[model samples]
Target chain A: MKRIILALAASSILTAGAASAETLKVCAEGAYPPFSKTNEAGDLEGFDIDIANAICDEIGVTCELQATEWDGIIPALLEKKCDAIIASMSITEERKKAIDFSEKYYNTPARFVARSDADFTIDEDGLADMVVGVQRGSVHQDFMEKTFPEVELQLYGTQDEVYLDLQSGRLDAAIQDSIAADDGFLKTDAGDGFAFIGGNQNDPAIHGEGAGIGVRKEDVFLKYALSAAIAALRENGTYKEINDKYFEFDIY
Target chain B: MRFELALQHWEVFASGVWMTLHLTALCLLIGGCIAIPVAFAMLRGGVSGWLATGYVYLFRGTPLLVQLYLVYYGLSQFDFIRETWFWRPPAYLRSACIEDLMGWKVCAADFIPSLRSAWWCALITFSLNSGAYVGEILRGALKNTPKGELEAATALGLTDKQVRRRIHIPSAFRRALPQYGNEVIFMMHGSAIMSVITLQDILGVGRWLRAKYYVPYEGIVASAILYLVITYLLVFAFQLIERRYLRHLNIKAPGAERGWFGRSAV
Candidate 1:
């Protein structure tokens, strides 16, 4: 009975692999809004997801959008849990050393947001006493750590959690991607008192080139395929249609 | 590759270790203090018993991470807390020691301010969580204190306080020490979650190092080794404490003389 069960399990596993072989597994951080987020209906619907589906359409492959925690997205790609990461992961030199990234899909600047009533500057001296919030394992965290070493940083697991702290006045300010702040927080009712405090921060060392789909270093073919599909989407006006649905200006 | 990177960032690891050690130690001490009273209340029975039971159940039922969020983020949602100030303990302490410390201690005035602080929030959440588990362990130990000893103490004309002080409490602690040691180790492991709140514990430092170097293995392995070392040291310390406190309960071995795996080679 044991031997028969083992053989059956093996066959089932093989069939499962075959089923997924033709499907293009695209992982995304569903918590990051405007880029990618889960809607009220428990479906992922956002710029990154739309863009990913468009790329799949261009490539003539069945697309599967999988929501993954941003922290584990790269590890998931490396482990073959997914074939590629369309998680709005910035194409930084540091990240490129580990995983391959396709051509830039979108570039968003970083900025600090605070309550409109509070008069705090975005500089080291200005932020010296203030408690700042940033998402853990994000480039903004790296930027804040390096730029404002003296400021008290409260790192949240998700970008939305940072807004929560900022809303409650627990955090004096929050540093994050500007577009994310605009669409995810500032535009919402919970962000009634908050406004962007400073000019956009754009240090390439931290912010990197832009967000790109991440593939494993060995998956050169998939990387090339994804890059081509992205380029085709831009040239064929599909990218613009999707872009207009989410944002006012060009994100590419 | 990971080891080389870890070695290069030794300072970060060291700082992380220091933070974890202090956070764990503080949490354990505070939690243990909270646990003892809760255990007593549980033993007493009635409304206080139910209250204590509810406290334990509430903490144990929820994830420590959620409890942390509730304290750090959820509690601050109220306007009363954000706009108000209460008595400050650190300020009072610094004021008391102002003359001796040459006013250099004035900086500590705001250390434990009345306002909500993320550090305090994390500490309180960890302590409450630890208190529940520790309380249950202690309650079990307290109940297991031999009834014969209590009867004998009463027969010897001992007062209730004397009986508890001389017999029950010490025996209960001695019995609970091993399980309590496990709780301490668990608390130490749980302290890694402090990284999410940006407190820079050993795990937090590891995270920072990984993000800075873009090498997860190096940071993760380095932190794991540090945690293992800390756990080993904690267990060793508990063993020493057990030996000292439970010396009277030790018995001679009935098995073969000690060797690898607690048995001599045939």
Candidate 2:
């Protein structure tokens, strides 16, 4: 009985310590490189990680990064597995119905990547029966489904898998974030023959107001805090520093 | 549990159900066909038997998910497979091979297209995995065939092939029906992994729904209910088949009527 009471007292003390420490658990996709990725040392690095850390620092909280798969990232946040999603999640209306988003930190248009030698126009007629790959549950999938209903769409769990299928000639083309496609695939050795096919696809209705940190609907305080942090980072040149480290061009 | 979300997206779930059903049916049909020869070979007890045993052991020894990943992802990694093996023919051949047949543009060159498609990869992997399991079940049933029946057939001057075909295989099939039914249901459940390779089977739709709405339980609960319905239907089918074929194996109740064919009606 005495030992049990002692254990309960110790658990209460741990809980109190946890409540006192202001740690913001941010979920990011480790598979998405340049934005966020796990290095050879198993540490999470990249633009998303840096931005998330900066936001936590501005909010006077310790940032804890959790690597999550893209497919279940939103659900993870809703389940309170993490406090926020700093993954490159587009602020679309459909997603807004499920979770609230901070102001956009970065915005890039979607683009289609295809083999360089493949001669095809980027239109409904050109891709009528072609199989186009997109990451499952992404805005790109919604855009493709709405824009080209006749085309066969193959959904992959990750952008990397879409690139893999594209490389193997299974996919006629793939739709993804332009910068992601450029850095993650087209710039790599495995993407030797592939090149961006279409022009920027920034349909406001589908691609939304650009990528933002996703927070729960009821976490209004956190959302505002994140939006303010993003603005502060931009003003202090911190955002530019992270952007320059990842890309040559302005991505803000 | 926002089940309303599942109800609202019934069409998506229906499509997922359709994919799962077709995949399961194709795998079972192809797997059952492969199992027969493999079972016979195993019974024959030669080098062929060893080969059959090895095939079964290899597939059954590993998880179905690993086998699926190997086929779907691993196979596409090889340039030879992507470029040549089972790939579409050259442009010249492709154009020349095109012929209209009953309003459908049929191209002979397109017959052996690459195996990189998710449907093809899933079908091939699931079929092979199902075949290994069904083969082992059939082999076990064949081995357990009564020695007296084989001897009786031999005494009647029936050829080895005749006795094996007429009596040996049929009896074993009847005995194997119950176990094979279970294998069918197992294959259906195992097919949920199709989602991993991006084929929108039942579980895939569920995952998609969860990802879309961020409602964790609705999609999963909906999927679970659909699986339960499928399993119930499968159980009913197996029961009907068992009643028709294996009724003779059941002990007769008092005053039960025997059918005209010398089988109990009950």
Candidate 3:
């Protein structure tokens, strides 16, 4: 009886393999530059996309970037809209609820943006009575609201929209990832009159260490593979190679 | 996951929720106001109507994100739009009342986005898309009007305009009531998509909450609650409208709708 059961189990596993083998479907917000944005030809090109591709290459698995909206990215992942989220999403205590995150990959400073004319430097020491704009559902929003309620905090839908208002002079300044501010707004004519206020501040309590890949908690095997792959890539110069291509500085 | 930890920040979350509700409501009110005329002109106007058709088609068909980029980024690229009558009021500056500030001049056109981009994006999409849907609804309701009623009005020496205004529109609205309610539901759901362009709807807050705690479950749950609340409110409002408009529905029994269900029912 035991032999018969064991043979059936083995047969089922083999048949399952024959029926379908899984490929890693990586999710990235193709609109976000440097971290994850699309090229003119609609190709995924960003720091996270490069890293995901390299990791897949190392694992000898076919990895695909599935462009999805940032708001629904996590929900889509939970519903299997793709396999993982490699977007520069922070691995915060709150996000860990629905899905699991890989180890911290990169840590970027969070800064507030103001029009060139506005002298409001975000009082990193205290936030009160100052209105700050940050992307809705970003660490910057959480930090501003939680740590500095004294200031007015405005939340936008995407990283770019936050800067649009800053340049238009509707906001005192926008609070966002420095890299995003630098790549998305700082380098452009829209951002010509803008400056990063309050220097780079790292408040890990609010701004969780830089983003990590997201996977279903039940995806134990894939998670283990990704965690290992991430470590190896960091040890090698692969991480730096990808980072230097788009950004002036290595994000990791 | 400790629920209390999140509950501790309930005030902030509450504020976010309130803002989202206010934003959605304002955008809908504003977007709807603009769309009605735009749709009417498209259907009624001559060559200029084609422009309306194009406007509706482009805004309705494309994803909200692209539209937002085209609006926010694409517009800023041109010096003409920045200088044109459209970009009036000189952008959001000084946080003071200047009555002359008109069009895209308010800083929020780019800066303080409570719901304007979401509104513009939503309005453009909502007004245009809803215009498309409402246009079809209007067309159908117009066609569905009883021929006998129009003949009777004509017999009374009423002009086409008077007949439409006094009798046709009112009767047609009554007929379109249920379907219009349904459209309201769809618009409510469609509003969630606005979050992509960064409208901080309930879903937006849920995402931020998730990003903060790394607790996707909690944030998602909170989002579900928010959605449920908004949906419930919309549905409640829909019910109120139905009850008010379809009060006649109550006096009749089931299957007694005497709808325009063809002569077979009579």
Candidate 4:
């Protein structure tokens, strides 16, 4: 009877491991809107949330969405706070040096937005005296520093703060992802007087290929699984469905 | 491992230290100026005294972070605050006689372009917050001043102003120094939050490094050590100041060996 109980307990432990094998914890930046944000009811919602869910559904895995600060999200993933990052993080060489990224899920260009009454242009010379704002720890900030070396750049903790400062005339202009500026701010009432001042900045050197699901560098199996799930979502038109909900154009 | 990365980026850490020191010094200097008059007002005990006390309560009652946000972001929300000249000094500074005596123009715009600026906002918020605490500390120190000294100064035919300047204020300041020293160090720690507004102070640069490298431990540890060193230097400087000003109070034991940190043989 003791031998039988020992065998049963060993089998239960293996079964428990198998049961939890398909469970994936995914993290997203709660502040980035139209991609991922916490709604009035305090639940995660938006395009990234839907895409994360769709990827999990395609792979037949249960997923949990964790909200984290954008600045600390990458560290949180590596620390095992979550298994993946689907918070619209662009695939970059600098980031890939630390962690692995799955296939690009979406591609968006950076744009400069300023108050309508502000007659400033977006060129380096035009923005000489202007104080431009960008979200800290973002590709936009990297691009702003490289492209507009002469212009003063202010880094904000959140994209929403850029909009606030722009409204108050504190920030002369702001550089951000085109869609975030459009759907997250410009499409809203707070961004009424503001308009996109410059054309799309799609310099690959700074913006990178596109947004991807980030995973641990050693998690090759998980990375492939996510890539396959993304492909499945694309083939099954789920990607297009989510894209249409948040954006009018195909971001893929 | 992070320490290696932190050492690799020593320049960033150095600049961070400079910015933290800059913020701390500005807060203390400006806040000290605000504290003196408020301390005197509270001691005077009138309607204006209650007003001064209320100012202290309002600022001290709230968190420094909240006060910072209120000045930096909250005040910018108001149209009047944004458009008006509320950021300029009081109308009294415009007095012709006072301006001539100072021999410098008192134009706020000549110094700062706008009060809504992040640097100004941070400075103002920190100064106001530190002023409240410093004012309270000074009040307590002032009250602890011996009444006999003031009576003696009066008996010596000293005016009320003379008595305050000669006997009361200096003694009160000497008493307040140790506590003020701690407050200064607290301000240094508090200045780390200035990075939240994108000030690029030591803590700001530390967070920037952490964000860039994704090695949070190294940058965090480096900043922690930097702050620790800064606090130690401040404490050492204050000890020297105490030794200089409060030398009469220390009854040195004969043949006692001094330790590395100014501690006696005991």
Candidate 5:
């Protein structure tokens, strides 16, 4: 009876997948720039957006990038509001327990930033115990809340929120991935008031590994398919070609 | 993601719920008191009177959240409020000023900070919004002051103030009891938005939890359940208060079987 039940559930899921073959729902915050952001036309444009499209095309599926709030991104996927999340989400042990992740596509070390004028340092009591901002759903928030309890933690819904608060006086400094801080935040004049402080204290805690595609734990097939495509993209020189457009060095 | 983590973190959810209830109660007590005088002012001033018109136009015109932000962020803009006031005060009171001035410091300092200067921001916004609706309720009840009842007090040789105090106020309140119950419910519902600031009330707790665990469904559902329960209890309290106070108005009141079991008078 249990075997039959398991088989029945498998068949039902497979049937659902076949029923929606043309469309694949993927989630992205679209708030992190160079990775993803809404353009003037409100269209999703960035490295992740292009990668999501390429993966869907490789897998012979039409992709729809759903702009979900960062905080709710994982749960939104678990609830099947979308089939997968292509947001710049990281693969971590804690996250692995709940969901499966595709192969690493792009990697960046976590770094910290503060006002250009502010004297900042990282050690036993790293964050000057001042207001520190981080994008809420990412590993950075978890790392900060755990490692530096003294620092006043301010969470923003998006990268834009973090950058805005960094520019304004809401936060003393922000710790995030170096590439995002440099290409995304420090690249702008508003972010110009800021400079990279140092590497993350939780550098050991956060995977600091490249980002991966997020699919439900049950979607083993999708995970492997995506992983295979990422390997192909890397070997075909397409990955390096795209990486040069966004970064000075390989993110992986 | 384990049931054990959720169980371990239950306090976060529980305290969040408790704080939300705490915030609602405080806002209602503080906000309800302020609304009464404001409503009275609106009522006594003729409809076009300056105080009455401003009370209605200003509070009623602005969104509750916007009003809250303005109160929280706008107050500390004065040098008198933060730096100057801090220096002017005796050293002993700097602690008090520091707490009050923190929210203002952020918004004043930030490009777009949440208005969270002081409790006064929430207090003022809650009072203004609740007062407008409460004023409307008071106005309706005052208008319902029976014409014959007013004359009877006059025939008894009572002064205008005495008549207003004794006969008209009492009877009008009786007539207004049902609407007033509705107003209290509305105020309670509106207090949830106060969590946007440092007021780590239930909603804020839920937000903190969701951010931490990424378990939006569980924490949010828990908070929703609490809001629902509190809303339900509030509704029951209103019905009970209405029955006790306005029972006499049953002389002209609808039958007890009327629309009294409302689940969402809010």
Candidate 6:
């Protein structure tokens, strides 16, 4: 009986694995608004989610979005919790060592957001002894840690918490993607007093090529498929539509 | 198992261990101190006792994670707490306060704790939570003190204050020591939650490593081993303490020899 049950289970697992090929499970950080966020109706929405759907459409696969925490998004993919990660994960050299990435889906520079009334230059010396918040394990964290070591870095689990501390005055400034800070934060009522502090901080060595779809390093075919789908979306005007829905300026 | 990955980041793990140790130690010390007065107040039975009961109920009833979040994030939402309650001391005075304090940067913060800081928030939350548990343990121990001992003290013309100070409290502490040891271990384990608030405790380092490297279980497994070693040490220390302090309570064989250091050679 046990042998039969085990055989049945194995068959079921094999069938599920076969079915998964047609349904691309994509992991996204739902807390990062404008990029990805869960709406009041409990549906995941935003640019990343839309982009993931468009990519899946281009690839002729069903898109299944899985909301995951920012910290464990990559691990979730590596662990097979999802087949791919469509989160706004910057394609850093450090990350490339762990996972494979598609071609650039969208590229945006990191920026610092501070209170509109705050007086400080966006420089290493100017940020001396100031408390700056950034999402933990993010390219922005790497940038701040490497560039402005004088600044006291407070890492939060989510970008929303960074904004929370920033608004509460616990943080003097926060570093994040420019579009995310603008649309998700600065444009909101909660960010009435905050404004972008500096110009685009596009340090490619640290920030990397841009946000890309991450897959397991061994999934070379999936990586190429995703890169091709991204290119198709860009050519077919679906990428522009999604970008327009989220931001006025081109994020691609 | 990616053990090499964890090994390569030994400094991070070491700092994590150091933070966990100090955080647990500080919380235990502060909580133990808070426990004494709370236990006494609960024993006395009045408004203070009522308040103590309420404090214990509130902290013990709710999850530590929620309490921590309330203290760390919830408190920051208030304007008063953000602006004035957590006022930073002047740089000169703060430096003066911690100038000779082993060069630890946090010494000044210890002297004047600010709720705005994650470290202070974590310390406050863990200490209060531990206090409630320890307070209840101490209360039970104090209540169970021998009636004969109290009568004997009274017969010897010992005053109430003297009885409590010299005999009652000391006896209660001795009785509470084993249970208190368990509380210390629990606090050490519970201190892992400090990582959620972004404090680099053992688990924080684990999560950070996992996130940074994308290796699923290596960092967590390393942290688990570290915790296991710390727990083993704690258990061994507690056994030694119990053997020394509670020798009379130990069951002995018919002809057990009294060994050196007060341990029985059974």
DockQ of predicted candidate 5: 0.28
Clashing pairs in 2: none
Q: Tell me the deviation in Å of residue A111 in model 4.
A: 1.2
Q: Each prediction's DockQ?
A: 0.31, 0.58, 0.22, 0.53, 0.28, 0.63
Which residue pairs clash in candidate 6?
none
Q: After TM-score superposition, what is the CA distance of residue A84 in candidate 2 from its true location, in Å?
A: 0.7
Off by over 4 Å in 5: A1-19, A123-129, A200-202, A240-245, B1-7, B44-124, B167-175, B194-199, B214-216, B251-266
Better of 1 and 4 by lDDT: 4
Q: Model 5, chain A: how large is the TM-score? A: 0.89
Interface RMSD, candidate 2? Answer: 1.3
- Provide the TM-score for each candidate, comma-separated: 0.85, 0.88, 0.66, 0.86, 0.79, 0.90
Off by over 4 Å in 2: A1-20, A40-43, B89-114, B253-266
Q: lDDT tens string, model 1, B39-79?
A: 99999999999999999999989988888878777777788
* Candidate 3 lDDT for residue B172: 65
Which 10 consecutive positions of candidate 1 chain B have the poorest summed lDDT?
A: B257-266
- Pitting candidate 2 against candidate 5, the one with the higher DockQ is 2
lDDT of 2: 0.85
Q: How many pairs of residues collide in each model?
A: 0, 0, 32, 1, 4, 0
Q: On TM-score, who's better, 1 or 3?
A: 1
Between the candidate structures 1 and 2, which one is better when assessed by lDDT? 2
Share of reference contacts kept by candidate 4: 0.54
Rank candidates, lDDT, best first: 2, 6, 4, 1, 5, 3
Query: How large an RMSD does model 4 have?
Result: 7.6
Across A195-246, the per-residue lDDT of candidate 1 in tens digits comes to: 9999999888978999999987876666677777788788989999999999
- Residue-wise lDDT of candidate 5 within A154-201, one digit each (tens)? 666678767765654546788887887888878876676678776544
- Score each candidate by Cα lDDT: 0.79, 0.85, 0.66, 0.81, 0.69, 0.84
lDDT of candidate 3 over A14-55, digit per residue (tens): 343421233567788876666777788988887888899987
Error of 6 at A2 (Å): 46
Lowest lDDT 10-residue stretch of candidate 6 chain A: A5-14
Worst 10 residues of 4 chain A by lDDT: A5-14
| Candidate 3: stretches off by over 4 Å | A1-27, A56-85, A89-105, A124-131, A156-158, A161-170, A183-185, A188-191, A208-240, A243-252, B1-136, B139-148, B154-165, B205-266
